[model samples]
Target: MHSLINRIMPSASGAHLFAVVALAGLFIWFGLMNLAGLTEATVERWLQPHPLAYLVTPYKTWLPYALGAIQLFAGVMIAIYAVPQRWKRVSYGLIGAISIASLSLMFTNPVWIESLGGFPAIGSGQGLIKYVAILGVALWFLGTKGANEIMLIGLILVLGWIGAMKFTGPEAEGVWPLLTGSPVFNWWLTDFGKQMASNIIGVVELITVILLTGHWWNRKAYEVGLLISAATFVVTLSFLLTFPQSWSGGFPNLSGTGHFLLKDAVLLAATFILYRD
Candidate 1:
């Protein structure tokens, strides 16, 4: 057992391989569970409390399958290929397709936003993030070995979008009641801590992106890129867990579609770590 444990322990690349496997498993498991006819009540009781699950009703039926397939492919590539040079381009293409389609789906469907409340700018900004991210993915696909800089640019654009969306517009029309604390844990929009946390994270991410981009030509570029990717993975996972697990299923749960959106982020992170090594 000791020897086996040592064997499985990660190398610089292995760390990323393990993460890819875990991520793939989560996608397959959650996706399969939802596709199966498991009772929502039972699943909820077993999983613990989360934001409403019924909200993601529209996208869940298809999105999970897509995600599961991607995760599975990613895990397999990492495991089978010691060096990702050949597979890297394929992975980027898959991720790019997923990102572009997911963004289109999100913007093309207004029912979800309307079901809650529609802010024009928020919708527009989300579209922009996906657009820029697609460009970032394209850069990687073009065999730019140091594609981290492009990714950093994407992150900065996304962070700006996030901050602008959260801190301004209809949501920010009024000065907050100081008494209402930050909405850190609450899944709903009303929570002050949650909004503040989102904005702060966005700002920090913007700085990180800028630094990572500036360091692209530096000798330590790969190292810096890996750090940025790790930070993003943490944030994406945190966002996933912070919201209700069912949120991915439909309406009240933005987490479902949101998870698909993060798919590229994960792929990008993995790609960078691999490229750096």
Candidate 2:
């Protein structure tokens, strides 16, 4: 199995390039969402529950927008960081800023314990907690020379397990709002109703897992899996635009649902790694 994986995986340089592009895309996409007020709920949710929430309460009106602009700038810098020898250092600075901003959420978010199921149990907070791994990946990409196959395996397990859960009654019901709001998925709800629509999505995700894991055995299957995985994230990420309620506190406070979907940013990045490898 190890030999087969090595044979199928992309060359080290190719994988590294793919990872950079994927990370840049995520930063840009997420930054735009913040600047456009699409992720206002998320920003608010993260800030309002922090121990120092009162300190920033006075600047609440404009803080999110300012942060959004920073995000956008950092993403652009990261994208072009390697273009010129001088710009490389600037890019590292931007990456540091972005990393600090994201990792700081660990201290600010209240749901870290209960919603994420504490330490032993992985629950809804899995979305937020996964940022730790993302941070590590960023560090690895910046400092290391080789691919981290373990990260790819981690993504497969998380996505596959979550995809499988979608078939269950509770899981199906959980995604109803997202399905109803999504233009791509809304039709499923209209045509098949909630349960079946959820089941359909489940099947798609399961198939994605098969394709991802099958890369060791079938190159064609891996290519198809990458396509499906990209499409899935595109559809899921669109929920930020379609669902107004995803922003629980009007513009910036993310409700439970919004928080749940925000993690797709990391998942989207992971997809790129899998696609190349």
Candidate 3:
């Protein structure tokens, strides 16, 4: 099995090394930031519009610290080439767990959906559909190489749901006009652009999810999947920066865009380590 893996696993390139190191550094930073309680200040500022702000507020207290620690651990393990070898199943299992929690939060939290709103009323339905979809996706990750597949399926579902909601829902309708009509040229339309960009990203995410999930059976495909995942992280960072309002907070506290972008940057860096030998 060791010989088979060596023959199958491609040699690590400069790009792979850079990505792995970056991932480790980011996760280490993330974990440290959480331990320092920086996440609380960040989350408190960004969640102004959330209905269950009070209910989820506890996250500010511990989640950042916890996830940051996880990031650091995952990063170190991957950087050392220990995860996909000695801890492959455990590593994937953790990914699956995180994905499930993320999906659950999406359904339960209006703020999350609101962050990605395309039109105005598209964010309706009281968050039930999102929960069901997230749960379904998370369930797909229980088997071997299931995390990638579940992610891909979730992205497809998110795209479809958002697209359909934008067309038929009221909130989405409000946001869509800014994208299509005359006001699109205005600076204020930046919010609309951000949401649209997120939707477009959803398309790419769907593709990546499918490619990564299915790549286990084909080594070449697996390599491509890693590249796609890295690219998605870059795209998300660009998208968030481009639309300041999408972040929804003041400066210094690292609310709104600051918080999210930082988190994602960290996530990207950590995940990239998985590609290295």
Q: Write the per-residue lDDT of candidate 3 for residues 1-277, one digit (tens) a residue.
A: 4344334433546434554454445445555656667676654543444565677666656756777677567556645764555563444345445545544444344432355543333343322233332333223323334433443443334434544443333434444433343232334544546456435534555665565554457665655655666554565455444544433343333433344444444334323434443
The Cα local distance difference test for each model comes to 0.46, 0.63, 0.47
- Tell me, by lDDT, which candidate is best: 2
Ranking by lDDT: 2, 3, 1
lDDT score at residue 46, model 1, on the 0-100 scale: 23
Error of model 1, residue 6, in angstroms: 22
Arrange candidates, best TM-score first: 2, 1, 3
Q: Give the Cα error of residue 113 in candidate 2, in Å.
A: 12
| Candidate 3 ranges beyond 4 A from true positions | 1-29, 41-64, 82-84, 87-89, 111-148, 163-235, 240-255, 258-277
What is the Å distance of residue 208 in model 2 from its true position? 1.3
TM-score, cand. 3 vs. native: 0.44
